[model samples]
Target chain A: MKLISVKLSPLNSKKNKLKFSVTVTLKKDVLDPQGKVVQNTLKNLGMHDLKNIRQGKFFEIEINEKDEKLAQEKVNEMCKKLLVNLIIEDYKINILK
Target chain B: MRSSVIVFPGSNCDRDIAVALQKMQFKNKMVWHKETALPKSDLIIIPGGFSYGDYLRSGAIAGKSLIIEEVVKAAKFGSLVLGICNGFQILTETGLLKGTLLRNKNLKFINKDVHIKVINNTTKFTSKYKLNQILKLNIAHNEGNFFTDNDHLKELNNDNLIAFKYSDEKGNTSNLSNPNGALDNIAGIFNDKKNILGMMPHPERMVDNLISNKDGVNLFSSLLG
Candidate 1:
């Protein structure tokens, strides 16, 4: 019988904290009355060239994960499960670190 | 009938709903949001309040509370679930009911009495009211405008899932009568099974005759029957 030896790397022991940012916005079809009010207010404040301004929410989340891809996947799951309301909102996730 | 009222961190209406339930002769219990298990309840009421201070979005955070999972399970099992005001937002956020409550068109936190017509009185929640009956109820919220995609709107209309509509005293629904810019003047709706109802109006606030009118009594009475 042949014996095999396994080696563990320092990277495996060290926990890597990944940072991600999630931006949530209402869907195009859904009306954004709050955004509309903001746009109007901005337009009145000497920003006539502005076509429109839609408001959205942003979240910075830090997760302890080793793989970048896995971290992103987990963030996406979080967005779908709690961060986003699919009925009227859409979300985009980005890796910050 | 036994009932349970969910109390979240910012759920100021918890006691109000509990009082209303007890006044209606139904044994009621106040369940905190952190509790994972529900006490075998025939009716679960998610009362109106700014849960989690309306963090992220109205009802967004509270929808993910530990107790909400059990509420969903109970609702799926054909137990009656009623969500009022912010509770309606929570229900929508949980996807128990379709659509979302957007900010008022005027971007104002409206707090006043509004008239809502009972469009369908056959459901367990509205059986005591007459079809097309008009009820004046108190509504207090910044995000009360109900919105849904066209497809879902069509389905709601086709299935007659709409439970109430903002209407005048004469039971005429129109844009003028709508306190908020809710699509089709909708004030409330039911899940496909008709066991879950989400409405923006505060029926519990209107139960006491000395404080407010007793128009909301039939709602509790209907559940008793």
Candidate 2:
């Protein structure tokens, strides 16, 4: 019965835009066959140095916030609630600016 | 039996299920994704098909659609909810069902009939069949692999909510019998309350005798029972 949580970041009191990047990838436990096929194809094409190749999705998002801490918390919440499926994917949030 | 099938824009299996339900003499109503409230029903089925073109994840977009609000409310009130294939994905995305459906292990769009063992037939969905009965059902999708963490799996086993597993003709369940490489070879699972059901197979597609195989007829019969 739990509803999807919508997390809103605090507005910048000084009207400054914040920059952050979010990367979503399949978890290590989950099998990424697409990535594996790519690796095999590369190996067949004479790329033997590659050990593994995992496919994932990445997103670069920006929001209006002044405080770095608030921005971090907000974007992290976004990844958990919507941007990523924690069941199968791992996400990383990088605060660029 | 009174039943409602929620159809999103990309849902192509709604009509098939509607016809299947009608053949069972069910009072079937097709509810749109834009609709607000669900009609009174004994059961609610979210039929398969790529909702919102399966973008941003298979069922993510359709899960946030307006009609799901009513689905959550109705499920909370104990109305039986069954989601098939893409519908199953939507259930997981909406948090109505636990775990998620990941991409198939082979990363291929598998389309064919597979045998599914009836793990537990005591519920409304499988009561018409004996426990461990094997039924043939259509499975078509690229992301039908069920995934869940260890802790969640323990809880699921404790709750006895698991409903079906991909199996062979003799009802042997193992790694080789698995069609989608689903975790634990799970093809269907029920909610903790045993009111919501989600599975990757399309039983409606096999319910008709015109198709020669009528193995799926018992499922709808159980619901109407």
Candidate 3:
């Protein structure tokens, strides 16, 4: 499974609109069969060291807010509102200017 | 009695459930998902089928639709809510019901008839059946594996909110009887007030005798009364 790789740059300016990146992943306890299938496939292909794989989604959300703290707050709300279901998933938020 | 079935885009089973309601003598309306308000009705049903093509997790997209706002309001004010198949997924996603449906442990879409025991007949949905009665119902879905944290499971058990449990022909529950690897053989559940029901089985498909049997007629009849 291709996990969403995000490289965060430190917030350097106050006027620039920040690009809020959010990663949603299933909770550790939830079973991820698709990831397991990919793991098994990789193991069959001779990557024997593969122990496991867990699949999840990622989103790069654009926010209009200029203040770093306010932008982070908005992204946090977005994650709680729709980007994730806390029942079986966890989310991480990253803000980059 | 009056009833309404919410019709979301890509929902294929709304008509089936509408037919079931009509046959049971309920004045039923097909409410589109875009509507901001529901027609005054005694019951609102979320029927089976792939809403929003099951994207971004099954029922996740539809759960956020504006129509769900009305659904949540109706459910809270004592209007009965019934969710079948994908509807069950939506109910869970909406937090109107608890738990999540993980992909089947066997990693395959299951479609077949199975026996479910009525666990809580006191609820509005299962009142017609005696407790522990085995009823043959059809379930068809890829993600029907019912999962909840241990604390939630304990609370559900303590509250007697588990509406249905997978069982054999003789009403015996065991690991072998669970088709979807659901926790505690749970096939259906009710919210705290017992006004909401979420189950993977297609009771609408079983409401007609010509189709095979009217095994699901009692469920509708119970609600109609």
Candidate 4:
């Protein structure tokens, strides 16, 4: 079993809470046109000295699982299922711990 | 029935919608953005294109146009309004619709012919189709991803405001539903009153059988008939 690093945050506070925070990104092979546009704009504005402008998704997830390992597993499952488009996106986990 | 297509300076699809209305034998008029009043019409259309060059946000600046005030009044009177693509963005900006169009998840200006399933056919724009039937139409846009708070999304669903959902031939949905890559695969929607229709696909672009699929003509015929 992979040792999970977890970043815990309160996503929604109700009778029961949901803790969620994840960052999903495009696969390296996929293009980032919006990032390129911003890069060009910056270049035109005389910032000609930057590199690797890629855009990615920032997702704040809210799920219910008390066990840290179970929470990590569930979050990973979500990334594979809906949070990231496997065909075009790549994901990395940032657990608070 | 009296109809008018509102034209802002950069709206390229105004004429396309007018032509569709013309084929339907509607007395369609072109109402310019500078005008303070719309001609007496029960149906109003705000067609697609980069209105106001899509500055600030996709349709933010254009929402404040002088002509839209008249539209707000008309909508209050129970008149019908249909907004397509950029027109949909403008409707969201003007608060006639709830939610905003975010940049495509892929962040690209995607253009493609996609399939849309009629989710709610009880509205004026979609009454021609059966529920869950798939229709083909073209989608062209960058700022077509729809976003709203969970409460609002729930309200839309509970109120039957969702008019269409984009899907594939197999009817599977996900991030993949957006052939043009819009959010939640939402292709169209109606206001709470069911009098306003806002869709991303260009029904006008598909009116002629030889040029494109004639699926769109049914919508007009249903409204007029």
User: Highest DockQ among the candidates is held by which one?
Assistant: 1
Clashing pairs in 2: none
Candidate 3 lDDT by residue in tens digits, B1-225: 989999999899999898888888999999999999899989999999999999988999999999999999989999999999999999999999989898898889999999999888887777788888888999999999999989889989999999889999998899999998898899989998999999999889998778867778889978865
Which pairs clash inside model 1? Answer: none
lDDT of 2 by residue, B83-191 (tens): 9999999999999998999889878899999999998898989899899999888899999999998988998788888899999999888999998889989999999
Candidate 1: where is the Cα deviation over 4 Å? A1-15
Clash pairs, model 3 backbone: none
* Tens-place lDDT digits, model 4, residues B1-225: 889999998899999999999998999999899999899997999999999898756777678899998998899899999999999998988888877676776667888898888889887777888888888889899877776666777888899888888888766666767654455677788888989988888999999998899978878876785
Please identify which of the two predictions, 1 or 2, would achieve the higher lDDT against the true structure. 1
Cα displacement (Å) at residue B107, model 2: 1.0
Residue A70, model 1: Cα distance from true site in angstroms: 1.4
Q: Positional deviation of A44 in candidate 4, in angstroms?
A: 21
| Per-candidate fnat, comma-separated | 0.86, 0.64, 0.50, 0.14
lDDT of 1 by residue, A5-45 (tens): 22343454445778899999988888888799888899989
- Models sorted by TM-score, best on top: 1, 3, 2, 4
Candidate 3 lDDT, tens digit per residue, A7-94? 2223423345678788887889888878988899999999999988888898998777778789899899877877688888989888
